[model samples]
Structures are given as C-alpha cells and as structure tokens.
Target: MNESWMNEVSARLASLAAANPARDFEKNARGLLSSAFARLDLVTREEFDVQSQVLARAREKLAALEARVAELEATAAGRVK
Candidate 1:
C-alpha cells in the first residue's frame, strides 16, 4: 500500500463524495470502504454463484447414485434370500 496510491484513492473518494452531495456522505463513505475491503478479500458474487450451481448439480448426482446403489443392494438381498 503506497502512500501515493492511497492519496490518489482518497482524492477519488472525495470527488465521489462531493459529486453525490444529496446522499448521506458518511454512510456512503462507509459503504464504499466496505465494498473496497470486500473486493480485496476474495469470493465475489459471480464466483459464489458458480460454485453454488456446481454444488447443486453434485448433490443431484449424488442422490441419483444413492438411489441406484440402494436398488442394486435390494436386488442382491432378494437373490440371497
């Protein structure tokens, strides 16, 4: 985190705050800070959504495999009896 870069960011933020005078400046500033920190921290919404879909598909496939396994086990049990 370079001091110059921070200064640049601060300048840009000040410009933004000045531009939106009608809004609650402090709240908006906090929100912007939070968003920037979140961006720095990983796990964006798009990536999360993609992983969620993948997990759902995996769960569905697991359910189907479980059902098939149960059927096979039942069939084998019947033959043994």
Candidate 2:
C-alpha cells in the first residue's frame, strides 16, 4: 500500500521534473542515485527485518540443540566412569 503511493508520487515528480529547468541538476543527480541503488540489488527494510527475525529464531534453536548435546555427552561420560 505504501509502496504504491510512493511509486505514484515518484512518477508525478518525474513528470514535473521533465519540464523544470531549475531542477535539472537535482533531477539528474536523483536519476543517477536511483540507478546506482537499483544495480546494488538491495532488499527493502521490511525484508531485512523479517530475515533478522528468522535468523534470531534459528540461533535460538541452535543454542538449544547445543545444550542438549552437552547434556547427553555428560550423561555418557558418567556412565563410562
């Protein structure tokens, strides 16, 4: 929803910029920055946050597994001793 509004505004701004000589430099600079950013293949902030949450969950799982392994190893060692 927000993305749609942003795209709409960007389109309108581009159209207005086309005939505005005063903003020629700003327009060119904006064009260059956008293209450069596009080429970088960056993800949106929302996507990053989602991935961060996933990674955190994964880390929690890993820690639990590690602890279980340690407990199992300790039990086995006690039996041998």
Candidate 3:
C-alpha cells in the first residue's frame, strides 16, 4: 500500500512538472517559425490581387503586340510577292 501511494504521488508531481513552459517544445518552435515568416516581406491577398491584375494587363498587351507583328509580317510578305 505504501509503494502504491508513493507511485501515485510521483505521478502527480511528474504531471505538474510536465506542464512547465520549458517542456512545450512544439508550441515554442511553432511560435518561432511564425515570427520568422512574419518578418519576411510577404504580400497580403490584396497586394497579390493587384499584382495579378498587373500581370494580366501585361499579358494582354503582349498578345496584342504579337498580333500586330504577325499582321505586319503578313503585309510585308505580300508586298514582297
């Protein structure tokens, strides 16, 4: 009976010790990584959307220029013929 009581007391002490902040490795690592990522100059969704729109406009302009070049090339070829 005494041995069983000692085991129960030791288990309770261990449970309390385990609750210390120093033992929270997973939470600490996650917080550290979150802070690291936040330090980076990452864009928000609104900024990404604005950049996407800019890229789309650039693509459209490139397509128009390509079509214009093709038309000019065809006209030049016809003149040569």
Error of 2 at 47 (Å): 0.8
Full candidate order by lDDT, most accurate first: 1, 2, 3
lDDT of 1 at 80: 100
RMSD of each: 8.0, 8.6, 14.1
Give me the candidate number with maximum TM-score: 2
Q: List the residue pairs that clash in candidate 1.
A: none
Which tens-of-lDDT digit does each residue in 1-81 have in candidate 3?
357755755565465557756556456556655665576668899999999999999999999999999999999999999
The backbone clash count of each candidate, in order, is 0, 0, 0
Could you tell which candidate, 1 or 3, scores higher by TM-score?
3
lDDT of 1 by residue, 1-81 (tens): 667857866986888778777467777778777876775667889999999999999999999999999999999999999
Cα deviation of 25 in candidate 1 (Å)? 15
TM-score of each predicted structure versus truth: 0.52, 0.64, 0.57
lDDT per model vs. reference: 0.83, 0.80, 0.74
Residue-level lDDT of model 2, residues 32-67, one tens digit each, is 568756766899999999999999999999999999
Q: For candidate 2, list the clashing residue pairs, or say none.
A: none
Of 1 and 2, the candidate ahead on TM-score is 2
